[model samples]
Target: MNKVVVKKIEDKEIVWFKNSNSYLVLEPIAAAILLKINKNNSLEEIKTWAFKKITAPKKVVKKFIEDIFLLYTVNNTLKKEVQNNSGTYKIPTKYYSEKYYSIHNCIFKIQFQTGFHLLKIHPIFAHLETESQNKFHFNYTIFDDKDFIVFFKNDAFIGKWNKNETHLFEGKLSMHLIIDIYKKPETDWMGVFHASAISNKKESLLFLGDSGNGKSTSLALLNANGFDCIADDFVPIDNKKNMYTYPAAMSIKKKSLKTLLPVYPELKNAVEYHFKKMNKTVRYLPPKNINYHLKLKCKALVFIKYNIEVELEINSISKIDAFQQLIPDSWISPLEKNVSVFLEWFLELPCYQLTYSNNLKMIETVTKIFNNDL
Candidate 1:
């Protein structure tokens, strides 16, 4: 009974729904049910239509519709409040300095107290602040009765904040804010990729792999060899297929400290963080000679695998295979034109699978591939 916009992305095998400021991804069957909803359609009519199309039973369809209705109602209410409260804020108990930054022309204002040591360690954002109009902003402040809170412009709390333990909470809040500002529906970016990127100044190489597959290690090695590090974990691709550098600190695991320390002596002073989820100790190090604001066209896609028992090797793969491997880790924009342009740029790149044990051999193989010698 609610008004919503539904878009079918047949190429991606997913349907997108935009309800106010919220976006939801639904499968074909669920999407069909959503499409059946209209101003005139009763709940029984929608259920009857869904049963005719979907193979599910009457009870399953009923539950599905109930879930969708709940989600839609909750998200719609939040979206309306967020939109109405934009550019308005309540005075905080403690005011901090507001810093402005420009990323792909989208402005973000981050306000944090000088005592918040977490902000000081994030050197990647050091050079990004400049005189700019604020498009999105969040304020970090502490209260007399409560703990620290990162408040949205509407004074809505971003997340749970504690005064005693603040590092991990603030770190997550910062990432959430970054994603919010960069991945807005009105932005021109195609989408975000869970891949690391490095450039030779002329063209960029994107390294895609699973979470523990050495993407950051490979990028660190390339950076040590004079390649410009574009992004460590998430790469933002514009509508034009240009990859923008996300200069977040690279998280290097303790296992890699022996090999990477030789190349980057600065890692000796890097702060150690124990990631409870991964059960690993990591050091967040700033990429070497990184330009915080740089965009490069992707020239190659490499799927990397690090194996202690395997010899170094690089093999070419078809575009179809590359796409199949990349789709799982990629968050493609629901916009039809954006998806088309991204596919064009992606298919134009040469794809390769690189397996290696030693970093030196891996570097050599990558260099040869880049030079067309492989």
Candidate 2:
């Protein structure tokens, strides 16, 4: 109700509301009540109006009000601001290239040759350097967007771009850059794993599982318990077999909202997204601190599987089994001649398989593992 703005687009079915840090989608009924929210309108008045307008039961209307209030009360929500700098700078048509390494030291060199200025370098790579500016340049061009050849070097996958869909095109391009950085060939010492990592500034623990297997939930719980999240969804592993933080926003699915809302109240105002293919809703929670610890030696690895029917259970697993489980979801450097060395280093760490329905106990179990008490 406070500092919230609602607007209906011309042809869109869902109404949009701008909260402090992110935009929220509202159904027609919810939008009706949201549009009527004002400083003068009391809760009783809004509820009465909503019930009369929708012909729904009072309890249902009350629930809607509560949901809107939860979103309204969130503080310090992360926001995305768009800057329009079009037509301000000279647009080059010739070939231009940039090279840089991520915080985890994944090397990337992107070459762009275009006559159109609409396709500015991906915003994420704007701060990175060109090959000429950096001392070291990778052997292959990670991304090539020239007129004749527009594909990722390792995969040879070309992307389609349109001038009218600049925002969508740029977003896809950014995703490609992230993938290339994680799977670049020249960075033999680094690899990307499909896991979540958290640390206590001394040692890091990794949670490996498939998508929707509660990796983000575990990371969020760890964050609430005095631990810092290194990465969620995808983490980088260095030459020393250490897990490094990739400071992207943690994507929390809708089902985990009730579990996380109490721990992270700011999530109430997180940006909501609908994944059509997955048929699930998700929200992105920004990191607590943009500046996080970059390097962390992996203390342990736990393969987590959520089972609602069972309580917390922890079992030690063989290193060979862990290696096989990790390989399927991970993206490693192609130039790495021998995979055995990486596997050996990873297997040296303590590994376990955690199955639990209770999130609180899961956190406790993980804490005990880190302290060597479990």
lDDT of 1 by residue, 79-126 (tens): 433233323435455545666665555566655545444343334455
Supply the TM-score for candidate 2: 0.54
- In the predicted model 1, the residue pairs found to clash are none
List TM-scores for all candidates, in order: 0.62, 0.54
Per-residue lDDT over 21-119 for candidate 2, one digit per residue giving the tens place of the 0 to 100 score: 233445666656655564556778887777778766778778879887655555225466644232332333345544454433655555554423312
lDDT values for all models: 0.67, 0.61
Worst lDDT 10-window in candidate 2: 9-18
The weakest ten consecutive residues by lDDT in model 1 span 10-19
Winning model by TM-score: 1
Model 1 scores a C-alpha lDDT of: 0.67
Top model number, lDDT: 1
